[model samples]
Target: MRSRSSNRFSRPSAQRGVALVIALVLLVLMTLLGLTSMRGVALEERMTGNTYDRSLSFQAAESALREAEALVEANRPTPAALAACVNGICGSPNPADLERWLDPAFPSPPNPGGWQAATQVSNGPISLTPQYIVEYLGDTFPCQPGNPASTNDCKRYRITARSAPGGDRSVVMLQSVFATD
Candidate 1:
């Protein structure tokens, strides 16, 4: 039998650097995995930020809509001008304006002819200024008996409000109808 000392160091030389090579390969693969994970996280963060901006824009639009409705309600004494409306419905996209507020295909400007710039809205806080139009839907039939004094000369108004976030292409549009006294 061979001496114990001779057998102890007689292992194959080819395996000497195999462990080191395996360790380096593993390290490279782990680094690649880490980079991929980081990229995914970054993308998610961007998406979340966009969602927040969209929310803000929608809220602003809703606020504008309420304001327009209130204004129409306040005009209780005098009747709204129907001749100024586009087809007697859209106040801004009137026949004289270059852009049509009611048309989705048209890129509506904030200040179309008869459109009134919204007041009580902070221009700096909101991305886009809100605009409103008061359309007068002609006479309405009496909802009750044939009493002339009881007949209500009700007028209909259509209000449209738009809001958008800064640096984002997304926009929010809100529209509502209101009846006058």
Candidate 2:
């Protein structure tokens, strides 16, 4: 009876810091989770910014190409001018003449120094600058009336424009053709 009473009176040993350890572990896990979420958000923002820059660059390039094509069409030189040239037609107006036609008075110069001249249609000319790079590909092959391979007297031109917005570069290409009818 005495022994039983003594045992009942004895206080149970305290749970040695188990609660503290659990609390610390939980805190560490929560901190890690928060940090990971923060990192993910930051990465997403960066990606969005980059995408926007690329989009702007591509738009600029496309605009440049369109301007160039219009210039080519407008400045188709005389048949004599196209004949003197080698690449396509020396007697007809060439890309160089087209470049010259780009009015400097415009807000942006269509054919800056970066504009390159092509001798033949093939890859055409390329322009490289700190702000952007453009590639113009022209085709003078006339299309055939009946046969797909055969060419008529029409000429085709393609221009590719590439630009970098805030140093983030992108490319845009455009193609067009003119007939001597």
Candidate 3:
């Protein structure tokens, strides 16, 4: 009869480290997954910060626009002064005269020729103060052809406001038309 030791179950020496190799592979995969999720979270955080900054810029621009409108309502500038664009009140009536407002470089550093800085009392975190420009779009006559003598002549004005936050990283601009009594 054969001895029990002679028929004992045994593994090859080469396969002794198989379990260790499998454990190492699993550990590497887990580490990669964790790193990927961390990157995703970091990206989401940056996006949220950008959104909030843009919202603040837009609000600052709107406040400047309202201030310009108030200025126009309080004291109307003469057409001659507006024609010369004195103190940011422009009445040139030429569409090209207002082209500078669209120029990215024009307002970033501020052009003393036309931009008017707003005195907005900001209670939030904003990088730069808002600014505005006023353009007179000429007078509008409400009288029809048959009623040429109608006394209602309204002066139309276009107000443009801009805000640059984070050193021009984000810029917000707004425009509105206002009529005077």
- Which candidate number maximizes lDDT? 3
lDDT tens readout by residue for model 1, 1-181? 7755666667766657888999999999999999999999999999997787677667767877887787677763234443444311343234454544556444334434455555444435545565555555444744343777775766666677777323544677787767665
Candidate 3, 1-181: lDDT as tens digits: 8756743566645657889999999999999999999999999999998887787778889989999999999986646523655666876455544475875554432566567888653645545588888888777645343677877877778898887445544678999988875
TM-score of 1: 0.66
**Clash count of each predicted structure:** 0, 23, 1
What's the residue-level lDDT of 100 in candidate 3? 52
Of candidates 3 and 2, the better by TM-score: 3
Model 2: residue 145 alpha-carbon error in angstroms: 5.3
Task: Rank candidates by lDDT, best first.
Answer: 3, 1, 2
Worst 10 contiguous positions by lDDT, candidate 1: 85-94
Best TM-score among the predictions, by candidate number:
3
Task: Sort the predicted structures by TM-score, highest score first.
Answer: 3, 1, 2
Task: List TM-scores for all candidates, in order.
Answer: 0.66, 0.54, 0.77
